[model samples]
Target: MTSASGFLHSLPMRQLRGVGPALAEKLAKLGINTVEDLLFLLPRQYEDRSQITPFGALIPGMTTLAEGEVKLADIALGRRRALLVRLRDHTGGLTLRFYHFRQSQKESYRPGLRVRVFGEVRLGPLGPEMVHPEVEFLSEETASPESGLTATLTPIYPLVDGLTQRRLRELMARALPLLDQTDALVDVLPARSSGGWTLADALRYVHAPPLDSDRRRLLAGEHPAQQRLAFEELVAHQLSLLQRRQRQRQWPAPACTDSAQLSEQFLHQLPFQLTHGQQTVLHEIRHDLQQPTPMLRLVQGDVGSGKTVVAALAACPVLAAGYQVAIMAPTEILAEQHRQRFQSWFEPLGIPVGWLAGKVTGKARQTQLNSIASGECRLVTGTHALFQDSVQFARLGLVIIDEQHRFGVEQRLALTRRGLASGFAPHQLIMTATPIPRTLAMSAYGDLDTSVIQGLPPGRQPIQTVVLPATRRDDLITRIAHHVASGQQVYWVCTLIEDNEQIQAQAAEVAADLLRESLPHLAIGLIHGQLKAADKAAIMAAFASGQIAVLVATTVIEVGVDVPNASLMVIENPERLGLSQLHQLRGRVGRGSAASFCVLLYQTPLSGLGRERLQILRDSQDGFVIAEKDLSLRGPGEVLGTRQTGDISFRMADLLRDQHLLEPARVLAEHLMRDNARLEQALLQRWVAEKDHYATV
Candidate 1:
């Protein structure tokens, strides 16, 4: 084994030459703490200084290489002191300016010395000048003395505060040769794999490719070397998801085999019949519940797709078998909404409905806790408080999570564990109103089986969406007054609650006041994030009961605030929100039989992307289609909410462009885990370094 491959992977950056505390600190900012990390820091671009051009023919904005002899070197003073060197070739003369220099540095640029310079040229007070250019002094023993230039492909790396491209390229040059002497570093991929390359070779090519390599492909992230690295990263991620699912399934779950009695009773009592999509998904959930292993299923449906009914019906099996069921929501309002719905449906059947939340306190809270612990709270609904350590279940059997994307993976896993009673894990059913595209679901939720509700229930009305400029403010106000006077409710959504000054979004308070002045006969209410939970609940309740004609609120009412009577929605600066958010807001109305409409009021001079987003919303009411378009337009992070939302995130692989690699990588991951433990471990160690907990496969 050679020095580079033998120990370089574990070598600290501080051990490298010229990497003192200061330089190492600067490098650390770029996440380069080890020799291996430094090796992986490929050049962001390259400079073609291979051909030397005449000093007189150099273009001002073009970077070129030139050889010249130093005529005079001295210190010049203006607003600041500087060392200036005058160099001349046969065609023209150029000046080299250095703002900070020592006397010894000036000595190196003495007269009668041949030097090579590479940099962008600019017209200064003197002739074309190259400010602080890279200078290489030529000596008698220098290999390129005739040209006085290093005629090679120059790799330019990204640098930090105290680092320079030249210094980094030199470090790469020193490290590259060491790998040629060692055979310890091995390729993780099998030789049979197509487009495979040795790990060491890939590193060398990416850091310092030949001048003839494909630059276009490199810039577009289509280079063979880059594809190989991306594919490897995707496989590691897929393996992590597969292994997590496997680990979770190893625990036993209580089998609700005799849920027919409970399901029939619950289904017969529904006010309306279930949609075909809902029935199909419910069947899938019931199938998973009877299995010995824990059920990890995701139920995705658009807003108003009857997901709440499906969730309640799915729990009847677990509830009837003398075990507890827990339902978790993302927000207090959503949780309370679920509580009311469940209480209305279940209390008639003599079953108890337990409600708990951050706001639920005193004797009521203790009573709910006791009911949960004493096996009396057969079914429970609440926010994150349901998973708190103080809350326990006597024989927890099933766990249902609503708006699951809004919760973190740790939170979900903790709730899953809360259902573990007597070595039996609970059946887990996670629901999300934000429809996920097929490619995204395959990559992000590969570990769980997915069932999607593709259609809304009967009697649902398609929302009429329109894009209007804010100039129609007066017209919109008149329209709103007419709708409210006709016994219809309105949701006037404001993106901000207070004046941001930086943003032009209409604040909730300002919008409410404007509406009140325009239509003084209508009762308007305001709600935003800054308002207390009790206040928000009260305002939402009032708006739902039709006491408030116009409900001016922020995104707080984006989800789980159901008011079937609200048929008009006026969104101010709708372009400020994402497509999914805009879709969710549109869904708030159009729930009732009355003709519904959504007015997207936008500020003028919209951006291209913003226009595209609004246009997409205006064209489609299908959440799935809108979601796919949103993913393409906004990328995954914003579409998935945030890093705190516990959705899947990839650092190197992109779901939009690299989605083609997901299914194949997922297949390969399953094979590796089942047949090749050594290779799987190697891949996890190489790519999924810090995410080892999820890579236990």
Candidate 2:
């Protein structure tokens, strides 16, 4: 492999001309694998140490450098494992305390020895004291650099376990000069014809600022280098999405001429008219289905926006073409709900429907698989089990994934590959009930054609959201009982599954026992994550069918469980949940034409971030608008759940704060791929090599 000149291909810290193995291990812990990595490791913070003050002028609780002689050295144990040492200069004396120290190391200090201590000093009963101060030995012949100094500032960096600020400074000094010798790479950014410093100069100036004024100028957006780096990251990301989209569009799809006819038939049989948003999105889906090439589209809609109906419409074309369609949901409960709803809708049209899940067993599982393989099943719905080796479709034409955010790129690719293995690649339609912010949608889903269902179904009432402190538990239960007495169903969502169950069971048992004393007619059922699938299903069924008046549950009911009769949702300790989660929980209500109410009971003394989260929800009902606010309030990493995989990984460019970087980055990415293929290939190879090294480590 070719190596860039002046840039060390590898730098052993021990062989870096000055460092040793002990220091090398310390540097390695901080990811300083080579001279290049060390060069790029920026300082976390800077402290000005150029000004040194006299002992008389030193203030307690301020970091200052003091040069003094060790006037007295003795091991005097205090209350705990404490050792005290006294140091004095011509002006004053300061006591240095060590809480836990080895006797041998303490004995190394000698009286009259001069040293420079850099750390914070605090006022003690005696005068001023410094505990375990950072001390550096000095020579008697050499006057202390910190002696009688007025002012000084030093740069501090994030240190690893054994690394020190001094070691890091030395490493940077060795590497920074090498960066100057390396010729600036071909500038991918357009020149600032409007009159400013070039990108190369900006980078150089930022790296080695001439003065404190220059450092501030570089950091204050006056330098073009920061902008250039941000733009490069954005463009690289946008280009990747565009390329993937282009590749997807090239796949051939089975011709489905009967899509419109089948879609019309399905719509005519619906119980209610479609919302305008639903209609608009359905029109978009029909256009994609009628196209000669495969369709890769994303249907983004808020909770309870009738997205399932739009998905049902998209599947019509495949069923009408005599090809099978498969829709995958994230969980078994959601899969069952889709299967039941779709089965009822398609049963009238003589289209066979089948369901596959982890629960399917014996002849039932075999029957479903056989029907799907033989082309007898027109629409198949399931969870991740649909991708199992045992599951096969005769002529899968359309693939619709519900809750697309929960599935990674590899899972989506696996699903697409399954459809293609049968001959023709199926048209892909991804649906997300979690409304993505506009900026996020553009960056995250730029590759797919997007359709937004912005409105809810007609006759659905808006849920009344109310925030209540958890201290008013008794009053809240009284209100809940009144709702139950009126024949309305109530859902009490708990935060945890097991621990919450125990807490809820105690709360419920206490509440039920109290209610039994007054009114013994109401039935209270408890459901949590620990329950068996069948038991959970039974509990949910009882609540939906009105067999139980009030059901206490975990957040499992946040997704696809629909009950029109349930009108009350009481979330205990709402602050414990995220903004998105609370929004989803509230969505469980207001599904019916009846007026619904959601009470968010939060704990006292809420954290600043937590209070802001709940306040945003109380102020708005629009999920997309709330999502944008959430992104702004919390960073992209928290909003996207850092644990999420695939293309979501980003190092420094945040989708929220750095939104300005996106469009320009996208344009540059396309230009590089189209106009500069060699550079694009080199970047891709470098990215993969770095990823591999990271994974190995």
Candidate 3:
């Protein structure tokens, strides 16, 4: 039962005791292989049938177990190809109907046969029926009352095509013993603070709860054991991020002498005054740029918090110091948007700016590339196309990445390395509109100098977020018509289009179609991810120019599209979106003097999480607050979509729950590195090796 050093390195499908070739293939499809993976393959849900009641006591739609005698076995052709079997207990009669049951099952359903059925029980014409109930035979030796019923919470593991719940349970049972043995070995957090529970205790408690309340508590993520495990995962993540930050800190940056003067000029040139938050963050950025070490800073602000302006101010010092600056965005549209904004800001100051992206082609792209290479383009902005082999910068000093989460670790490193190639690494600024929870920021962006813009501009209007049920579509459309009539631009976001152009597009089209009929005179433009590059750009241009009064779009406009005239954002099916997304959508409005409004339209009977998402939007416009709530509700994984990429790499830690673990882990990492750099390096190497081996197996 002990964990061997190379145990996780072995192919899991091959080592699983009862897994045959066919079952192994199925396990592979579920990404379950090796002992480690199987151990960590936590159940998606747990069904509690431990308190099994009698058939008569069971309510319709309530999952309960029923033991009965097969009074009759009738093979009658049912509507739409179904087979019906009627069974009766001493107190009640129930029918078992199967749509695809074969003739072979008939022999087992003899009149005298005793069977145990586990599924939902519904009232039928004669009495009650269980449709496609999981069945098992009853024997004298195994006829304990609990035998007919699930005596404990049944752990429902994630499944694959050919894998069954039974098979997954069996495999999990076998793997549990092995996992338990290594529970002591896997200790990453201190035992005292972990509520006196070991990892083994947590796993056992999660899988086999002794009571119904315990099952509920464990699944709800309130159990101490679960918290311990989550902490361990967070500790590992924090340690990794801290290490990355430390490594980046070692990189040298050329100190810019003109930083203060440039920053002053950038601020002076702005049309509006900077918010206190913006000024504080810009000061932090200025301080970082003044340091000899390259600045690996993350500027996180809510949508429309004027983050780009802060970034512009940071870039000014590098540009003024005769060093070229480059900004990379996640999408072409965002890139174009940044390009235009930078042009507007810099062109007035006579600072040359260049644009490059996937769509930028032929002579224009070539000319931009030449400008960048010759240092004629002091400020270059584009998508990942900026990292293409042909693109080069004469003296790149500052690299700003917008929506940093969209790009991977390698991509960020590639841009940073470009600056280092010439022996002069640039100051790095990573920006995101998605407000990361504080704990997550510590774990995910620990290496970066973090700056948060918590306030909006002085004259910025707060977007009023309102939640409306889908039944009030007519009222909402009328409101939109009224807004359109006033010449204020509106962004109607859809969750899906007719052809799946984007999930948002479908919702946008429905709203657009309805709005078109209501306000036929207003110019309406449809834009989505599936549209051609030129078309999207054209649509965006028309909207920005006020030619299009209403623009129907997907989440594509969530990041950098700026139209001060657009005062309203109607997000249809807002329940389908995350809190961060909803916040971003709302940010599209309230950028100008016009009083902006955000209508969050959702279908009735919303889920608990859905309601929480909408409520979070309605309650606050602060991205940080929304982000914390998002982490609490959805966990860090879903909140940030952190996968294998270094952006979001926590394996088990819930940021909302384990915020305390981050600083300790970060400090420990630094202390470890300081005491023995080689030891720290070796540990990181081991972790990476283990991760690679885990991926391969």
Best by lDDT: 1
- The runs of at least 3 residues in candidate 1 whose Cα sits more than 4 Å from the true structure, single-residue gaps closed, are 1-171, 178-183, 190-193, 196-198, 420-422, 496-506, 644-652, 690-697
Better of 1 and 2 by lDDT: 1
Give RMSD (Å) of candidate 3 vs. truth.
5.3
Ranking by lDDT: 1, 3, 2
Candidate 3 lDDT over 193-261, as tens digits, reads 677887667777666666554656566666776676665555445556665565666767778766377
Per-candidate RMSD vs. true structure?
5.0, 5.0, 5.3
Cα deviation of 9, candidate 1, in Å: 5.5
Per-residue lDDT of model 1, residues 1-697, tens digit only: 3332245656778887878898888888987877767776766566777677788897788888777899999899899898999999899999999998899999988899888888889887887888889888887675363443334457777778768887888777777766675543545666455276767776777776677878787765677776777777788878877888888888888888864887888878888998899989988998888888888899999989999999998898888778888999988888989988999889988887888899999999999898898887889999989878999888889889998778877777677767764567888898988988888877667778999987899878889998999999999999988898889999998874244522322477888899899889889998886767788789888988989999988787888788999999999888878899889889999889999999999999889988888989999999999999999988777787674324455444567878888877888998989998767766765565444444221
lDDT, model 1, position 358: 90
Please give the distance, in angstroms, between residue 487's alpha carbon in candidate 3 and its true position after superposition. Answer: 7.4
Which lDDT values do the candidates have, in the order given?
0.81, 0.72, 0.75
Question: What TM-score does model 1 achieve against the real structure?
Answer: 0.83
Worst 10 residues of 3 by lDDT: 688-697
Clashing residue pairs, backbone N/CA/C < 3 A, model 3: 12-34, 245-447, 494-504, 494-507, 494-508, 495-503, 495-504, 496-503, 496-506, 497-506
